[model samples]
Target chain A: MTNMNPSDKALVPFVSVDNMMKLVHHIGVEPMLRGLADYIEADFRRWELFDKTPRVASHSAEGVIELMPTSDGEVYGFKYVNGHPKNMKEGLQTVTAFGLLADVSNGYPVLLSEMTVLTALRTAATSAMVAKYLAPKGATTMAMIGNGAQSEFQSLAMKAICGVDSVRLYDVDPEATAKAALNLAGWGMNVVSCKTAEESMEGAQIITSCTADKQYATILTDNMIGAGVHINAIGGDCPGKTELHKDILARSDVFVEYPPQTRIEGEIQQMPQDFPVTEMWEVINGTAKGRTSNQQITLFDSVGFAIEDFSALRFVRDHIQNTEFFMDLDLLADPDEPRDLFGMLQRATQ
Target chain B: MTNMNPSDKALVPFVSVDNMMKLVHHIGVEPMLRGLADYIEADFRRWELFDKTPRVASHSAEGVIELMPTSDGEVYGFKYVNGHPKNMKEGLQTVTAFGLLADVSNGYPVLLSEMTVLTALRTAATSAMVAKYLAPKGATTMAMIGNGAQSEFQSLAMKAICGVDSVRLYDVDPEATAKAALNLAGWGMNVVSCKTAEESMEGAQIITSCTADKQYATILTDNMIGAGVHINAIGGDCPGKTELHKDILARSDVFVEYPPQTRIEGEIQQMPQDFPVTEMWEVINGTAKGRTSNQQITLFDSVGFAIEDFSALRFVRDHIQNTEFFMDLDLLADPDEPRDLFGMLQRATQ
Candidate 1:
């Protein structure tokens, strides 16, 4: 063993919330969203090369904490995320997250990052990327049904990736719609705050619904949808939570991230176990058809798979290479002699 | 949400390797080992109340990364550990780890700590704790078969928790034994360096076998162990790694932390599927027998479990209160008006 001091191998690159915000400003939010979309699209094309597993969740009375882990044969990534809807009323975030990426060859962590903001960016990017292939041709207007924490991100990602210029926002609470509208003011999008959900859907070719409720609440009904409109349903992510009506799901040709996970947590949880849903990776790789005709309705039922988080972490690990957007965290113990860890501790006194 | 500037709730207390070493010195190693033993014994007594699952592992050509998670209804804890035997050849640690503890009520992380040093402490403490109940009466000598990073900790923990006054060390490499013996010189124990494994067991009532190899190799054969001794086998902790001969296990009454995991990763892996084994928790809680006769041989088939790590994290979380040994990590994203996360990012630009 070499008698070296703690080296760079002992330090993990940690991206804090402040640094992550600075990174967003450094890259520009719209461009970063487009970048995440590109990375996510590339990973989706090689989905078969991933070791995929459903998230391991620990549920309690108030909320659930989950660990989502995935590996791409060379790199391993996992996200530690929690969902506590009751936290919102107590002035806390409903969802908070962080993530890590490690080298698969040596099993050492390479990056540790704050993933709450990144999760939002990646979720929105994934929605827009799927819509690029499944949405109606030249769809420029989207009816955003839930103007919550994820609404402004969805609006911006669509503007960057799918060339959408108009966003009609509606929320159950008017203040939420106003909040999203105020944030999107200077982002070069036509932000329209609507009083009712139906008014938000008027003349819109794409309808995106994202509502946060821990119940089986249908934010979108069957009669509200029109033909050839792509429905981006992102909020139905847990066992007892769904945003679209079953009739709406039965009519639309649905696409999902992973069938095993989406079948249990996505909008299709309300359907049978063997529900016919196309995997988005197959569609992105051209093995499956997407939006065959203008009259056919298509829906992207997203529950936020582990591969999206893996891609987002990959982007962060690459982008933070030569930037001052991260700090070296002394997270690993590197002893001078590998067999003398206790001696190293004893020497710490000197 | 309140317009607070990253309040304490958003910050997790992080203990780095330097801080962990300082903390070990601050509390003193022997006292800390005894303290950890107390926490682990307490948790094991209430083991049925915990949410236990086998560790999630990602295997590769050279190493493996594992996530061990458990919850005790009030707090949730998990450790991210990797074992890459090839790392030691490249002047790196064979094992490195970090862990987190979160509040079950809100799913917010409370503590984040470097667990490389802590895992060594807890594993040794666990072995000594098991020997305290299972070893023969007035047992004062221990034979340490593997003199690697864990040897000195095991010797010290036995001295602290089990009142072991002597330790005989042996290893395949003489340099490892010499290193352990040199570091353990002033620790108030009779440290003996032996040439062979048989000589290390001379007059010792406790035999601790810990060798780091990815394949099954019997460090202790059947005829080496005598009656009325406790065997702490901890190195055989993977699918193909084992340390003790099958005949030795067949003659001993095996005690295991978790049977399902031990059956796959412990010395009992070579035994039959329906091999009789007693849960250690039952022995600690007085529901089962331990060392009933002076001639009975008791073996602790210890493949480290999540509860022991949970106990160690709990010990750290409780002890680091009001101390300067930890730094605050801004790991969560808390926004004013929880639905206005985009507004928080927008305001950060100012």
Candidate 2:
């Protein structure tokens, strides 16, 4: 007789949508964002050790599906994400994602989690962590353009990780800005709802643009941007999409996630082929300079690389070690005898 | 109150291991293998319509994990598979896989199913499907070298799809050979267990070398393979792993699934960079020749491409419709308001 039962190693920890929200509230969202920033920064410091590649994308008429995979020789991770700009008209999120983490030693998935919310957290954390190094000293206010789903998370992450005291929200749609201001009402930061993008940039040392349009729309013109401000550009990630004017990209000292990817998908895609930009990891590793003078503009052009997702999955893996934040999913089949797969199926008949 | 409940679009259909075996029994395994062969053949005919790329792999000291992704401009699919030859030593399957099928329109995953067993069935079906075109006329017996987990599936697939009525099994370990022989006893095929690899090839027209060792082992020497026969070499799927000798590959008119991939992972990896081989799709589409002369040697050097996995997933997706083989998983977070993600989480707390 064979013990046709699944072992613990065969079971993967799965965090569903409900459990992800529970975990967020359990740890408090601010603390979780801060913790994720720490992990993202740690992974960035040792970025040379991890395997890196531009995300593989399958483009359709309506949207694009992408696989972002990376490994640190000990753990491997990949995120399945989709971007459908028209999804909002159909009452769906423009972007949704899920990720899995596996042990590199055996190639068995160890953690599976809904990354729609997690991606939001990690994206904001990555932006703020970069701002901490590139933003001007004594920067207290951030102009948050495009007050959509990511607006609140970006605000809180900046407040928790970058010591920002206030966020000025601006969106073409006033309802989106009102929604974000309402959501951030009791967060203790001076939340200012602005009428225009230029108004939002008033006296702000860090300007974060995260609008959700899939075309080359200049959300920030050359005249709107000033020197000494750190620009966190999050929207316009695909080939035909970008937020900043070409003049701004030419003048500012831009930093990117992965050059091969950011060259094709980030705002730099609008720039010339030989446009010079810095790799953020080099700055984190102290090989390159971040912000030399307050009069020089710095821009972090992010396209959501795989290492941030890997770090987020690693954070969830560590956080769920003792907490009841996930359920065991019988994802893999375990036969009593490894080579007896056929026999295992046959025994099930009896 | 804002509804925190997800919509129907957020639910992805999930098939578990137990359900996969049940579905196999429900549809009858032989018929499923034949159906999978049909789908594989159909996709191969339209090979130029697919978006093809070499699989993205993350390798470690122990094994490799890979993501095989493809799309037909309508439906998108990908398989997550891990090959750790050392797993069997610890009472685990050497390869375990799961796959996803998504609508290319919205980029939402429509199905997620366990593919550990499905992979074995599909790999065998693909081999036999190619042999149907390349094998000698009236070929009834196959020499199945390396009687590990994939042996029985290959035998059945060949018998069901390619009209092979008999199989001869040979392996370095007699216990593995005996296990496969016992499993195939009631499958209405002439199953022969041979002690030596050469004895298994006696009077056989199709030779399948599917040995499981990770290193290069010459399962079939130059003199062992007779002319006017078809060879399905499957196990040498990674770098530094091969089964057939270079001399055999040099003399044979080799056919490959995808040349870009086969050049690195197939038996042709033992050959030169400019080694001539026909793409199997060209043969199916009637653009190239296959098995023209009775005295000509033919080889199907299969390293398993993404299109085969795509076809298998398509077959499973079709079979699972209007059936109880799947359960809806809350995989994606869908809020009623597309941009009100924070509101959705805030309501979940209530």
Candidate 3:
């Protein structure tokens, strides 16, 4: 690591979307997800050092666009992400994102990255990180509810990080379930495509709900959950969106990534305002309990947070340092004479 | 322009920093500022239609980074900006920014522009717009305190929008004053470099403080002001940064953008919790009073609202549509099948 010298020629490495895809391809997906999970867990253990806030969102009739920003004194990062559920009908991804990492000392963007793929990786990595603590030891089976764009990453991350040996998947569209099953076929895990949510949860140690409908829909009921099962609730991530029944939330030992934000966007939104829940960071730090008994049920209400992206960026930055996968962007204007901003503009014009 | 058809291929126009500077050069600074002033005033008059919020800020030890987001339902916009006052000492611009405008229906970015240059222009335009409403009629003389990078833009904007023909400028660094004067030499306005703030304000109708220091330095005192003067306080935008003394604010009719944000970042921070200030939109909308008389001191305590940037993005988008000074950026991913995000990765990997 470089010493904290203020005057050192600071290096800000950026990976564009195309180049980032190349980097992922070079390293392979499973290894990248495992590495990202490790970084996320390590950062979560030191969560007190970060300045965090709920993402600021602007909602329109069609969808919502949000800015999720966070800083750790030395480096500041933010992602501009949009979620339009109906975008796929127009040949667009349901979500698109871009982000910037800046040097805190100068407030200059050192890295500008396409985060559409990175968000998928980071979100899955966060799920596995939470499951690493809450899920039963040597958990071998996972039930994936809703096989959409996020399904493949979630399946791979769970297999790679949590040692899941098989995944039972279900989606409203059988074609989606078939697509997920086909993707996971060569990954050395048993992929079981189920017809219903109840059938998917059979003998599963971890149940992941990542459906994309924008309303509160019950994908998992309390009766469907068995004891000692860890529920990775992922899709109920907005104000009006929910997945699990309130009974399931009330019965399980609920955990979340930032209590204030989770209260607004997580599955726990259906719970009472004064409902009790532990922050996932506390579990990662070992200051709070995860599962004390083999018979206890655990639920991790995972709404992606900025700190997870911060960790993912840190991971990508470190791994790509010795490689040429990063690109130098003309995002910040630097003048030879500090006061001559207009001089830089003048030179650029010429 | 495309008849607002949902299925039509809408043109996505962009202006890079270089292209924006060329546009400014081509259109002339006075006319560009005048056009921007018109856009800002029109947007401000319809403020209730906007989805407004206090900019989300991520503060670090060296400086602060902010995400300013706003929407008018049909279009969504946000600006990513950072301010590090000490950056100039390291040959970097103190503020660097970029912004995006998107279609609310699909959450697709319709325009992406470098906002560092546009921010300076829009900020000046906003100041001039507020001064047009709050300043005395036939205001021909102005005092510019802290003549730094933004001074020329302010001078040109005021000359075009408020008919200010002469400006008295002062900076702690004489070199900055010389630079400002040099940049404004042939701009058809008279520039006088003054030795101090007190000397600069003599016989001036508007007093603008755009200092760079990050502390409450009291650049303007109550004793330094004359009757009927309009103050366009530009700097001191973050917490712990202020330019006007409390006594000056106590006597002047202070106008702000958003009250909660202004209370924390604007010169109003120097006053009590219950201090009264008018939202500038109210005055622009004619719902509240502006300057009551020629003798009433008026102050526009601008902390730079998100709405102004929203207006600027709209202006840039429109102008780019009418011109050809932009490069198409593949910022979003288009998948043949929305559920096949992994397929795009798979194809890219191949």
**Top candidate by DockQ:** 1
Q: Taking the tens digit of each residue's C-alpha lDDT, what string does model 1 give over A1-350?
A: 43435678899999998889889989999999999999999999999999999999999888899999999999999999999889889888889999999998888899999999999999999999999999989999999999989999999999999999999999999989988988899888998999999999998999999998888998999999988899999999999989999999999999999999999899999999988999999999999999999989999999998999999999988898899999999999888677778888888888
Error of 3 at B292 (Å): 3.6
Over B30-66, each residue of candidate 2 has an lDDT whose tens digit, in order, gives: 9989999999999999999999999999888789999
Cα deviation of B252, candidate 3, in Å: 2.5
- lDDT by residue (tens digit), candidate 3, A33-114: 9999998988898899998888988887778998888888888888888898888777777898877777787787777677
Question: All models, DockQ values?
Answer: 0.76, 0.75, 0.42
Provide TM-scores for the models: 0.98, 0.97, 0.93
For all predictions, the C-alpha RMSD in Å is 1.7, 1.5, 4.7
Task: Give each candidate's interface RMSD in Å.
Answer: 1.4, 1.1, 4.2
What is the lDDT, from 0 to 100, of the residue A328 in candidate 1? 96
Best by lDDT: 1
C-alpha lDDT (0 to 100) for residue A229 of candidate 1: 92
Lowest lDDT block of 10, candidate 1 chain B: B1-10
* Collision pairs in model 1: none
Rank candidates by DockQ, best first: 1, 2, 3
